[model samples]
Target: MPDTALPPTIPTAPVTPAILESLRAIVGDKGLIADDQGKQPFVTDWRGSIVGNAAVVVRPANVEEVSKVVKLCHDNGIAIVPQAGNTGLMGGATPWPSHTGIVLSVGRMNKVLNVDPVGYSMTVEAGCVLQTLQETAASHDRFFPLFLGAQGSCMIGGNLSTNAGGVQVLRYGNARNLVMGLEVVLPNGDIWNGLRALKKDNTGYDLKHLFMGAEGTLGIITKAVLKLWPAAKDVATAWLAIRDPQAAIEILSEAHGASEDNVGSCELMSRTCTDMVLRNIPGTQDPLKADTEWFLLLEWTSARPKAEGAEGMAEKMEQFLADQMEAGRVIDAVIAQSEAQARNMWVIRESVAPASRAEGPGLSYDISVSISKVPEFIERGLKAALDILPSIRPYPLGHIGDGNIHFSFMGPKGMDRETLKQYSPAITRAVNDLVTSLDGSISAEHGIGIDKLDELSHYRSRIELDTMRTIKRALDPKNIMNPGKVLRI
Candidate 1:
């Protein structure tokens, strides 16, 4: 094949107010927005990695409204960018460069559609905030276990769209595993009512899975039936300082394997991570209050006799701590004795991001490998980044207990924007390459929104990328759904 000249350039799409008026009439003033000020929030991604201005933003109150809006957009040859809380990390909820497009905001559709304690599940509108769903489940004495940092504001719809994975993923699995059914509004404005809370449905095709992590390119998730668990009678949380990274992995393996998978959660934190949290985050005082190299946040939930006999469980936890201490693997430990205290411990762990940001700007990567191989990967990643770009401060910390870590590097303080941009981005890619070489995912939790689109080509196979594009084309033939996101179209 010889080099050939390409065809003439295509023209940009035109915008008209007549089309805007038609959209506004469908959604009403309260539901429709056209001004740049009103649209700016929905234009850029959470990280400000990608920015796009839409022709309008629409908020539909229900499935009927969403279907109508999507159908209208599709018919008018308008691109639709679906969004929820706009708290998504992967830029999954952010719109991209507009060839005359609109954003579909699901915020107005928030509602607890259904709660079935007997069924151990809750069917909720996609726009429902995670914290609101948690409260709804608490009212029934049941639990929805998709615990994460953004639970307070992140909408379930966005969570489902990205198939988000958080700390509790070790037990409840990712959002895809938690979702039993979905109610999606397709590109053609038809509704997919897979909202049944059935545990087992051997139907021909599990249509819901297609949109689970499609990031709204396939369709907009309007509602979802999520799997819930019985509320545990008691929970024990502990913060410990560990000897080494490898030993920390062994501890998690031993505890999770022996506890009948009862270990609720485990997280690893480095000294730099905690120091920044305590220094920056308001009301974030240290849990240890003393100098510690590394920390582990461990949690265990039990249903066994707490009122009758829980001495054995408490003793087992104490014995586990004692054994670690004796082996010099664990230097310090503090176990929560009450629910309030347990929540406080979590508050500290969740406050890491904001506190770290207050310290300085940094380039972060959320990547994962097998637990057994995480140490090697981290070591190599740190070495690789430093080799290419020394004088960079590494602030690596995350769910090492689960093989997922937000390995990041903070640029030299007080450096100008140009210098950091020139070096840090190169460093981020260097770390991502290291993640790929170990057969690990470049994106462990966050999807390949605009932020990670570059790495998708580097990590994903040609066949894999092609299959994804085929599915996207099949679901959204016009390529109007979330245009220029995930993959360049």
Candidate 2:
């Protein structure tokens, strides 16, 4: 949405019948999908905003097959677009509109190679779904703390490539911190096996970090070694009505102090976002009897269990909320009394994206500032966004505890898609300018795929951008891996 003018197209090596047959032989007849019907899902993104055309989609079943496929593509000088789960927001995983490349999907490589409970690590194939990994950790009485709404379908490779951050980032850190090692197939088709489960490794260069958040521009992540922690035995979830963003921040501080940093997730939602969820998503109701302009969904978890007259963490959390309410920081609050009720609270948080989309077309910003500057950023950012298009409805929601906010703006009622697209650049600039002024990032958790290319170029320094291009060129000279993604070089 930066401008109507398109970037210069990158030429791709032609995909002939001989190349297709060779690819098919490497993966099986079922692995190579050439028909339009079979390739549609891989080419299109989850949000449906980006649709790409591919000569074919190759699904490799193992690391060897992945290496071979990459090698073949590299030898033929054909571009390769690595896709997994296809749950990205930046169109990083999807091919370009004029792409004449083949999509290398790792979906068939789904497998859990090893799980060491004693070492507190799990080595899994990149194609493994996030939800399945979480469940597998739970089976071993541990927890993989990457909890996103798209966990059910988002693959570990995609999560790693994007370096995804979720609600629990305040406590567990992002995907970059959670990953211990990686097995990547480089752009030139050489395999780098660095899948070590060590806690400390002071090597010459921590090469895995290069590919972890590179958005597949350097290499294809085939497998990973992830860190795990002991599962929480007791979790306390609550919904609190707050006066404003400042109050939400104050309550978060108080919760952290009271729970000794046991607060796992502290999310903020605007009144409009909550309303959209209740109206759009089924089986969702307002948990608070009284409505406020802002809401906070907070939770605390501990490995210690409450039994035999011992005070549980949940009880302490309730007491903390009670004190906060008495002090007037929290207007009203409801603590989940049962597991079902706790899940109900999470439903509202997870339903935000779908509900907002259902309401109308909107420009979303996954931007973040310092924790103390959140309120100021939101207050000024909203006013600036509305200044551009007064009728646009601002729906800001996100993990405020970690300073990331999804400040989105819903289009005015009856606004056509074309009109909305036309206004996108200005709207994005308005919000991004405010974020930059406040020392915040325009692209927080979401990587700069095709979505934020222009914004990134505008805001980032020339030296930093040049260094990134240099690294990209060094790793992928042909610019064959995920072309036109992350960087324009």
Task: Provide the TM-score for each candidate, comma-separated.
Answer: 0.94, 0.98
Write out the backbone clash pairs for model 1: none
Best by lDDT: 2
Off by over 4 Å in 1: 1-15, 97-99, 257-260
Each model's C-alpha lDDT?
0.79, 0.89
**lDDT tens per residue, model 2, 172-216:** 999999999999999888999999998899988999999988999
What is the C-alpha lDDT profile of model 1 across 215-246, one tens digit per residue?
88889999998998888776778888887677
Return the lDDT, model 2, position 300.
94
Clashes of each: 0, 0
The alpha-carbon deviation from the true structure for residue 370 of candidate 1, after best TM-score superposition, in angstroms, is 0.4
* Model 2 lDDT, residue 159, Cα: 97
